[model samples]
Target: MVQRHGDEQSHVMEREPLLSGTAQPDSDYHACHSISEEDTGNGVLKPVPEEDEEQSIGRGETESVKDNAHVNVLKIISVMLLGIFVAQCDGSILMATHAIIASEFNALKDSSWLIISFSLAGAATQTLYGKLSDIYGRKRMVIIAYTMFMVGCAIVGVGQTMWQVVLGRIVSGAGASGMSALVSVLITDLLPLREVAQWRAYVNLVATLGRSIGGPLGGWLADVIGWRWSFLGQVPPITLAIILCSAYLPSHTSTVDEQDAAATDLLKKSKFSRIDFKGAFLFAALVLAVLLPIELGGVSIPWSHPLIFTLLGASAILFALFVAVEKRQAEPILPLDIFHSKDAILSFFILGFQTAAQLGMMFSVPLYFQVTSNPRPSATVAGAHLVPAVVGNAIGGIISGSVIKRSGRYKSLVIWAVTCSSIGYLLLMLRWHGNTNWFESLYIFPGGFGMGVASSALFISLQMVIDPAHMAPAVSFMYLMQTVWMTIGLPAANAIMQTVLRRKLGVRLLELGYDSAEVAKIISDAVSDVDFIDGATEKVRNAVVKSYIDGLWWSHAFSFSCSIIALVLAVFLKQRRLDGHKSKP
Candidate 1:
């Protein structure tokens, strides 16, 4: 027989022996086929059964359970996700609770800062957690994240001043950065490829649900109890999550035993046989330095402030050094090799665009209702409206998973996901002009369906391209990007709308030939008041209200365009659906 005997993973099989003494080219294949036939009397070749297949499957299942460091990883994920929900909810949650928190603190004039502080801090630190988890371990880093959150929660609960609460909110957001990508990392590490997408989709469903509902729940809780309890309420859920995760989470694959074992095995190689502190340090500094500017830009400080410039310049220098160190390090944290992979880079931008668009919707749609006279529902209704989206997310993910398993291809499903979602985004963002019942119903469900399908497709495609060893780091990379972009995306969209609205209103007033300063004063006065009595403000009032509506309409158009970019990227993907032990190379 000519088949390779030592390796079981080879895709090719060889035959033997009929040509051993003869000159026949196919004789060796015949000989091997005969031997196989003799071993398997019916001419079938398969692993010999020492036990029934079901019993064998059960025994192997137990061994797998023992091998996994944590038995209740899923439960921990559930708890961790709950924590993620609350923190993420806090970012936009302020939209609903803005008046309440501001009333309690006596800072009604500056309530917007509550939302901004949390969002900025959360965006800046997400990527930092990815590298930290890679260095220490997911389990340890998660604990750190919760501790930070708990600290923030305590600060907010005991606050006597608005700044103290801002500090608390900032701390809570930093902690959220850790939870952002860690869940998906653990999912892939703990499960088989066949199961990764469906399970990841479930986790994503939790994230989306928490994101949508967390705010309203915070609002209702504050109303029923007090605003301070909103921060205090988070502690119990986080405390429980820590206990469950510590008891269940295994040491990362970078553990000494796994590393040693990898050295002996060919298929499993350690990506971190030796640490590269230089690259890691530079990487963290680089991430922090660059993000500080983007996060604080136009909000707390001028964009050209010395502090911002110093931070951004330092970030640039560190990025250069980090790349240099990664090139030389035997075991690198950045894993430069991954950047060269087609799907890896594409997935990054694809995810970046996707998240940016999502963040804009989450922020803008809620604001639309909160500020408007009559809309679909109140801003508080975001929680209930999103329930359908959650169902859609889970369903789309499951359907995508099934399609891959049954058909062994991904491009078609990916294409459909992109197309449907692009149209859905358009419908949701469109100017329906008038309030028709059919118009409302038409957009919401279709948008949810498209979003759900695309969410699943993203997981499948990402997991397919990633190196098995850096699975956690890879997931972290993506999650960090999404959160960062999401934070920036919202502010950028809002900033654009605000600027455009001001310019348009100013132009209309200018055409009437009113003194520029007088026109500015009139518009400013209208915006300051909460009341909207038509005759009181009259012509000036309509201009302000019309400006807001027009700005929102154009903002929707911008978000829809971003979705189109993602749809285009989906077209270039080469499908790979992993089943059994063989994933596409």
Candidate 2:
């Protein structure tokens, strides 16, 4: 049992030291339960004064202590949010500037690879990071992730070729995967599921801010100092985040006493072996196989290509083998047992579908403005239009979190979130034609808002249904599903857009008296480069713009359908009341 008495105080009254047991150590439980003792430097444990403790307790200062603890936790979380901000900002920056960077390298058609590389690397390593953190400790893993991110930034900043930049992104994505998963794990460590929801709202707010500003910031940097500086500039703030985390973050407490020489030696010898390397490798392979095909098909190669079919086949086989391997492991990278809960399964799909729809809109809205606007706005101006969506997202997160924290209910919020997103997509499908007013552009706001609410509510709902012991793995799995769908959603949207644009633009060009060969070349160029439309005649420009609008409408229609599916899933999601204790529905 872990006892909490006052601010920054925790005492674990365990019958036996965890390290000495034959069974695997319950690191999560130990993290929550371990005692805190001040070392005198002379190898003596400095104990708290009994009278002082009694006096503090006797004064009925329980609420005061709780308040102080809450404030302290907020401070820690605030510092941690800086890292989240940096990661989110980097993502949005790339989203906004990738076209420019790819064009610089004359690889405009390959720009989608940058985001796909990141998502692929991230999805592959997400659960591995969570499992590794449980072994090596969160602080260590987080700092390592930050260092990796910095290294990736440096590589990208200096990269002369697009493939080098892509390699850098893969590295950065791995680090980002760790950062995203570990930070949430740290928060869940600090709070119960109920409070986690409330604080996560604040996290979402910071992330939204990062994403909102990053687009404009990235575009400005790309214009002023070139795109390379955009990557280089993030290093300093990330370094500061590392330093702050080192200085202020709590140290990981071991399950064994420091004075226990044998246990310490045993732990040092066994930590690496504890990692499920086989499961991790198979899982990563499975993800790469699955996502690579999705990203490459209809972009780099034909959809009917043998390589795509082969990769898909390999992915299916790898998944089965991975499942079989994981079931026998004592400490699987992804604790598959969590899926035994109906709520966990439902939450995963709900989150996946919602995230897919939201990301599709996020990628599409900016492009829609760039392609369809009469003046042909710069990347900065196009990116600025997303501010409303980000703001709405932040607001939705705060509202959902506050409601969950107060009312201890989230089912209705989940429903409302999907509904809002669906409505947003529907609006875009109907109203965002070749020309859209500023107000009409704000149609994406509700989708962003819905995403925020889903982010907080679905997570808390997942936590409520699982055993506390499975929290870390469960959280990692949720992220895996999310990132996997993100990988699928973006490419899927792009494919749909390209397919529609090609077909519509070809038909229009043919009607305009262009020969079949001329129409094919024009369609190819238009699909490959958005700038192709800029040099066209008025008639051709209108045709290109109208074709793009048609493509966007179809994309929005797809997103709307996804949102409706998520809403249906949300309706079936089981609700459990939060009462500040771990319990199943």
Candidate 3:
């Protein structure tokens, strides 16, 4: 039960009794209450009068209202899941088709931008979506996100140039960021912390299904119809999701303190002024400056280029300015105060490192199979290999959710999650050499499983450690770190692969008595075209494959390092009680 006091700005959440009519101890609840008492000097819990409570519980009208509210919550969750499915499915489709689409326009070297542009745009706007939804209402934001995603899909379907497709991806990514962040926020709003893990497992299951189907489905569609059709096919589902959200989602704003409400009413004429546009702009600029340099440097341009230095310098300045601007705003896009907690800071970095490792592997593994497998599998065959990992991800989430729900503990799960991912990456680094067996490919399953478990444990732990008022911003912040790192990790892994492959392949060709010009040409063609190995001489093909294996070894090493770091950080996360009842202190 939650009670709102007009004078107190904080929320007091009570623990529900167990089924056996026994109350469980809740240390965090008592800690919060103690803090409230120390601050206000009169944090007293009020009990309802027995007669009044009986009358309220006895009313049939109240029971009917309760039933209606429960039904409405179910309706909201059902529609929201559809939207989550669309966003996740579309992302996986792009992952499968990105190389094929980029090659069509002979922009294979620039294919990383296909994903980077989307992530860049998403990371820039991710945190702002939370604050905007708080002011404008979640339903409106959902409709807007759905419309933008649909329009972006339409643009990509009809795009005539690679740049146009990239532009569409930017738009779609912005909408997808919101759809993903808001769903988690909404789930938190509707459920207690203990239950959040269980529901999140369902969300992960849906996401895994989308990813599992999307890879093969996208590849098949690209092979049968055109790659353009892959983008076009997503439009109808997103449109339906948009309509459902507009019709079924409630249009309620967040509850504010009475004094704050009064202040809002007074500023009704200038409500738009309250938005921290300066902070938002600075943050967007900072993200772009930071990511663009990372994505383009040492690939499109030399790392030592003047433009790279300029962008890095600008990013530093922008970061300082963004922090300053946010500190002054009453309703900042990101609540800087959330970082005050040790747990909040640790959770952000843990999420970043884990996501970077997981997504980096996802970006690389499909290409690894296509490049290294015997008989040279088609795109569809290559994509289908990820099914084991997806299934593992779903199973891991379910198990972690069940364990957390029953045991009311997550710290151990988090440690195990990172450990499993580290071992998975270690196997990849050690075992995935040229012409790997089909069974050996199952090495990625543990990594996927670990990520799935981390998703639930980390999110629930973050919620337990922060103030309830910071929930929305904190959730968005977590996603922002995730997207930012993903954007960096994918390209970094690719860059490592490219760097290693070029040097290794070029040297091998040179030692084989090939001319410098021929070696350069062969290396260029091999990296840019996956089909090059199929058409090359046997000796050249072997060399190219060996170089790719060496590069992948380094990439997997990077992921393993990240996972190990996350595991170390997980050890320091302070455990909190899941149940809401006061402890027996």
Which pairs clash in the backbone of model 3?
26-581
Cα lDDT of model 3 by residue, 1-585, tens digit: 233344542553442111001111111222222111111112121223222544776667545544554454456668878778878888888888899999999998889888888888888888887777655655667778878888888999999999999999999988888888887876665554566677788888887777667766788899999989888998999888988777666544222234444433533534466567998899889989998888788778999999999999999999999889888977777778788888788888887898889877887798899988878888767867777777878888898988987888888999999999999999999889866787888999999899889888998888877655456778988999987888778887888888899999999999889999999899989998889999999999989999998998889988999999999999998877876521221
Ranking of candidates on TM-score, top first:
2, 3, 1
> Which ten-residue region of model 3 has the weakest summed lDDT?
18-27
Better of 1 and 2 by lDDT: 2
| Total backbone clashes of candidate 1, pairs 3 or more residues apart or in separate chains | 2
User: Which 10 successive residues of model 2 have the least lDDT summed?
Assistant: 14-23
Per-residue error for 26 in candidate 1, Å, reads 38
Error of 1 at 31 (Å): 35
Name the lDDT value of residue 345 in candidate 2: 92
Q: Global lDDT for candidate 1? A: 0.60
* Alpha-carbon lDDT, every model: 0.60, 0.78, 0.76
Candidate 2 lDDT tens digits, 1-585: 222244524443221111122112332232222122233121111222333555667545644544555665665567778888989999989988898989999999899888888888888888887677767666677888888888888888999999999999999998898887777776776654567777888887888778777877888899899999999999999999999877666555435545545435656767778788899999999989998888888778999999999999999999999999999987788888798988889899998999889878877887999998878898667867778778888998898988987888888899999999999999999899867886787888999899989888998888777655566678888889988888778877887888898899999999999999999888888887788888999999889999999998889887998899999999998777676444453
- Runs in model 1 lying further than 4 Å from the true structure: 1-95, 98-137, 250-281, 301-314, 370-395, 401-408, 428-430, 434-438, 441-445, 511-513, 525-536, 581-585
Model 2, CA-based lDDT: 0.78
User: Highest TM-score, which number?
Assistant: 2
TM-scores vs. true structure, each candidate: 0.77, 0.86, 0.84
| Model 2, runs deviating above 4 Å | 1-60, 99-112, 160-164, 254-269, 509-514, 532-539
Cα TM-score of candidate 1: 0.77
